[model samples]
Target: MGVLNVTPDSFSDGGRYTDIDAAVQHGMCLFREGAHVIDVGGESTRPGAERVDAPTEIARVVPVIRSLFAEGVPVSVDTSRAAVAEAALEAGAVVINDVSGGLADPRMASVAAAAGCPWILMHWRGHSREMQKLALYSDVVAEVRDELRERADDAIAAGVDPSRIILDPGLGFAKLPEHNWALSAHLGELTGLGFPVLFAASRKTYLGRLLAGPDGTPRPVGGREAATLATSLLAVASGAWGVRVHDVSATADALAVWRATGSPKFLGTRTEDK
Candidate 1:
């Protein structure tokens, strides 16, 4: 997966692709760069970010999705609003990547169930404004695992097929840097939830901190490409079913190399050659 944030306030790459034509072209570029899925987000979910209304989000993403769908690229709408998800699906998105795990909007699960599309349920505490305060956890992994299990149950009860659900630990949503590290180190525990896991640590603050300079200044998003690729390969080796990243070509190449090593675990790894 490759991220295409169309919002002007997203933490990374904000305002870079807000233009519809540029965003669509960027999505195609990512597709050619070997992204299996193109994830388009209209709203910025960065911590403390303000919310964008449903109509605005729909307007921002629908055209991009339509263009990508027409090009035969698999697209996923990164939204928590049921209205936006429904509109994106109708506009030709094949998946719904909800960061709220259906907590922010009651209709989201119903929308996914109705569309029968793969739904990525990310572990979330609250909306952007208040989520940072809600990051307290005795055991981040255990709490996240339990919360995700509850969400999966809710999704199934709301008519979503259990098989169509994917769980994301939400590395930086409400987590401190250490919490994000812990989650990545113990991702196998989340994968044990019996659903495919989507690891989305692309250009996240945790990676920035890990690659900080000698003066302790965090690396910028563009400078953290190597760290991101390392994390992606680690996640795949640790049993992640998919990874969300910005530099999809590099990640695809790294995974290809790891797959060629012929580990008993990665026997069937494949790469997109475009």
Candidate 2:
């Protein structure tokens, strides 16, 4: 998956793709660079970020999705609102990557079920503004797995096909550095939950903290590419179904190398044939 945040305030690559032309161009570039799916998010879900109205998010993503869809690119809308997901799907997105996992909007499950598209349910406790405060966890891995399972159950109960559901551990969403590390190290637990797992630790703050300077300053986002690639490769090795990343070329090259070394099969598949 390629990460394309078409918002002005996403933690990384925000304003870079807000323009419709630029966003479409970048989406095409990412698809050409070997991204199986381009995950376009209109709202900024970065920590401490404020929420945008549904219309704004729909406006930001629909044109780009439509353009990409016209060019035969696989697109997923990264949104929590039912209205936004509906518009994106109408505009031609095949997937819904909801960070809140249906927690943000009561109607999201129905929308996803109606669309019959793949829905990625990430483990989220709250919105970006207050998520950090809800990061408390004992045995983070188990808790996340259980929470994601519950979310999956809720979606399934709401008439979403189980095969259409994917799980993400929500790295850096409501998690602290240590919690992120724990989840990353133990991703298999999540993968073992009978669902495809999406590992999306691309240029997040925890990676910056991991590669911090001697003076205690976190590494900048631009410098965390190496760390991000390492995490992604490890996640693949640990049986992740897919990885959401910013640098598609590097990740594609690395996965090629991994495949050369006898690539292992991923855990699960989406309902639609790939």
Candidate 3:
């Protein structure tokens, strides 16, 4: 999956693709570069970012999704709102990548069930603006796994097809640097839940902190590409179903190398679901 933030305040790549034409071109470019899906998000879920109304988010993404759909691209609407997800699906999205794991909006599950598209339920505790305060976990890995299971259960109970469920260990939404690291190291725990797991650690703040300078200033977004690639490769090796990344070309090239080198696990776990 390639990250396409159509809002002006996403932590990374914000304001770069807010224009519909530019967003469409970028989506096509990412697809051409080997991204299986273009995840389009109109709202900025970066820490402390404010929420936008459903209408605003729909306006920002529908046209872009329509254009991408017209060009024969697979798109996922990265939203927590049912209305926005419904609009995007009507506009041509095939996936619902809800960061809130269907918790933010009570109607999200029904909409996803009705559309019959793949729904990615990310582990989230609260909205971005208040998430940091909720990052209190005794065992990050176990807790995240349990929480994701609950979210999945809720979705299933709400009539969403279990086969269409995908799980994401949201790296930064409500997690601290250590939590992200723990989750990254133990991603198998989440994958072990029998759901396809999406690892989206692309250009996240924890990576920046790991690459911080002597003065303790975190690395900027542009400089985190190498770290992002490393994390993505390791995630795949550790059993991630897919990775959401900012540098699609680089990630694709790295995966090619992984495949060429004859990693038995990589060879054995090719996704059976198209």
Candidate 4:
């Protein structure tokens, strides 16, 4: 998966692809780079970010999704609002990557059920503005697992098929750096929820902190590609069904290497052909 944030306030690469033409071109580039799916977001869900109205989000994502769908690329709308999801689906998006786990909007599950599309229900406590304050967890893994299970049940009850559902642990949403690391370390626990697990830790703050410098300053988003690739491979090894990423070519190459080596040990070494 390749991330396409159409919003101007996303933590990484926000304003870089807001225009429909530029966003479509970038989506094509990602497809050429080996991304199987393009996840498009109209709103910035970075911690403490303000929420954009449904119309604005629809305006941001629908045209780009329509253009990509016309070109035959599978697109997933990264929205928690039912209205945005409906409009994106109407515009030809095939999947809903809801970061709120259907909690933010009352009609999200029903809209997904009606569309009969694959829905990624991520573990989330609140919107970007209030999510960080809701990160308190006694056992992060256990809590995440239980919450996702309940979310799946809720979606099923709301008419979404169990097989069409995917689970995301909401790596950066509402999670502290430690919680994100813990989820990464124990990803198998979340994947055990019987749905395809989507690990989306691309250029997240946790990776930056993991690769911090001697002065303890976290690395910038562009500088975290190496660490992001490492974590992506790790997620795959841990039984993740899919990895949401920005640098899809590097990840695709890594996966090819892993398969060629018959899943050899991951020792943090470059496996690319020289």
Computed on alpha carbons, the lDDT of every model, listed in order, comes to: 0.92, 0.94, 0.95, 0.92
**Which residue pairs show backbone clashes in model 2?**
none
Worst 10 residues of 3 by lDDT: 265-274
lDDT per residue for candidate 2 within 181-269, as digits (tens), equals 99988988999999999999999999998899999899999999999999998899898999999999999999998897553643243
Estimate TM-scores for all models. Answer: 0.95, 0.96, 0.96, 0.95
Query: Which parts of model 3 have CA positions greater than 4 angstroms off?
Result: 264-274
Per-model RMSD to reference: 4.4, 5.3, 4.1, 3.4
Give candidate 3's error at residue 51 in angstroms. 0.5
Give the clashing residue pairs of candidate 3, or none: none
* Model 1 poorest 10 in a row by lDDT: 265-274
Clashes of each: 0, 0, 0, 0
TM-score of 1: 0.95
Which scores better on lDDT, 3 or 4? 3
lDDT of 3: 0.95
RMSD (Cα, Å) of candidate 3?
Answer: 4.1
| TM-score, structure 4 vs. true | 0.95
Per-residue lDDT over 1-274 for candidate 4, one digit per residue giving the tens place of the 0 to 100 score: 9989898999999899998899999999999899999999999999889888989999999999999999999999999999999999999999999999999898999999999999999999998888889999999999999999999999999999899999999998889999999999999898887889999999999889988999999999999988888888888888899999999899999889877866545545566832
Error of 4 at 188 (Å): 1.3
